[model samples]
Target: MSDKKIITVFCATGAQGGAVARALSKDPDLHVRAVTRDVNTQKADKLKSLGVELVQCNTSNPASVRDALSGADGCFIVTHTDFGKQNSFEMEVHEGRQIADACKAMRVGSVVFSTQRSSRVLGLQTRHMDAKAEIETYMHDLDLPLTCVMVPCYYEQFMGLFKPEKIDNNKYILEIPMGTTPMHLIALDDMGVVVRQIFNNWQTFIDKTIGICGDVLTIRDVAAILTQVLRPKTFADKPLTVNDYRNKKDFPGVSDWANLFTFRMRVDQIFNIHHTKMIHPQMKSFEEWARENADTLHNVL
Candidate 1:
């Protein structure tokens, strides 16, 4: 057996897993085995170039997952909530359970499952959030060491779902569901740094569920920051009530986001920004992240 601890990362071609895989590979005491469905992809080749071992595994297949978990010291698992036209809450739960069972059988030293806060925490049910909550419970029931790392809304959402629209030559409008309640947001890249910290001190986080956020901001707050960066005549905040947003027939995942915003209003401190800063001292704030990505954000705005 190798002296280095092996950490298996699922969805290594995707965002969260890729970040964790890269970070772990840089640690001298650890060895990274990156899992992906295809072993011949450009991304997989890049990971291999960085000294990461490539493991071909499919999350939907129990045997594949089991094989990947074998001889692993720790694992990072995440499930996608949206798959284009096919979105099923139960599918995510099923996949999560599969990974959990595999980890339990293999007796992995530590399992860091990327999850979301429970919908029940805010008195509403959103499909994605609810699925992750169920997975968290299932992992705990299996009697394995688990750390549920709940990531907040991505700051990158501004590039897609909440993209700014031009109202005039020099003005743009930012639409948000939360009227004035602060929404916790984080840069996806920073999630890796935090996860690396968790892996280094696994005992401190076992059986704990932590929500991480880089900043707690409102629509107006975001606009103010963007105004400084984009030099817009005026960046306006257009607040959408949960009811109004949920009823929008044109918006994708309206009901899901509606429930999320409603829950966010009920619990402003769900992400615990202060505690997150202590865990990953180098984490970036919204302003800092915006400044760094100003050119890219400006194009979308």
Candidate 2:
């Protein structure tokens, strides 16, 4: 029985939350309060078996989030905005706000928000990222102990995007159309490792916005890595033009997403020299991710 502080984590059933909660669960220095909308889900049951205190909560509801955070010292706040939500942007922003308010009112040691990497400036076309930008600002204004983790596109998302490449050569290509601008990709597994450290050392990080990325790769660089593992393949650089990204986007978020990826409306240096110096400087490369994700390579392709 190692004595550690209890930390409540929101969205514990989903990607960011699950990673954060799972990481915290393994640490002897921290206790995890895993929250979920469905307490009976396998994920929740699994967390319970691992000694996580399960809290049923929804971010959209302040009362639920507050109840989840009521007895905890800290929390990890993240939201899932489905593609087809009637009010996707509002839903995410409101959820974040509710989490922040609960953290402040409850006097939690800190609130770590899950945000996206975008411009240091503002007016990103993507509703989700822009919503994060807004929520981050509000979190700061409240003057509570906080750390905002800014995530880039997940390395996992690439697998979901170009399935054809996965099917043909058993190799998936990384195809973000910045022409080798080094799109930083993050592995979902690695995210938990980094955030676990933050929760363990809460005092050193306050009022900080850190860019979190496990790997960096361009369209071609990733393809090369895939070729090595899968063999004799070229990852296509299939980036849509500004017009196409805005007009021909697969979903309703085309214009919003195009605003950042296509037009570069908000490219920022949150991961600049100084920012990296503050946090752990270790960043994963595409090759490292490919090797670690080898288990999925055969099946994904």
Best prediction by TM-score: 1
Off by over 4 Å in 1: 40-46, 83-87, 120-123, 232-234, 249-252
Q: How well does model 1 score by local distance difference test?
A: 0.85
User: Per-residue CA lDDT of candidate 1, range 225-281, in tens?
Assistant: 988877854688987677876675365567777788777777655578899999988
**TM-scores of all predicted structures:** 0.91, 0.86
The list of candidate 2 runs beyond 4 A from truth reads 117-124, 162-175, 232-234, 246-249, 263-266, 272-283
lDDT of 2 by residue, 1-301 (tens): 2467878988898878887888888887788888889899998888888888888887778888788887687888887676577688888888778888888888898788887643435644567777887888888899878887877666676566534244354434443546646666677766787787787777776777778766656667777677775555445566546566456547656556566675342354354423533454564555777777766865666
RMSD versus native structure for model 2? 3.0
For candidate 2, the 10 contiguous residues with the lowest summed lDDT are 265-274
lDDT, residue 40, candidate 2:
96
What is the overall TM-score of model 2 with all chains considered together? 0.86
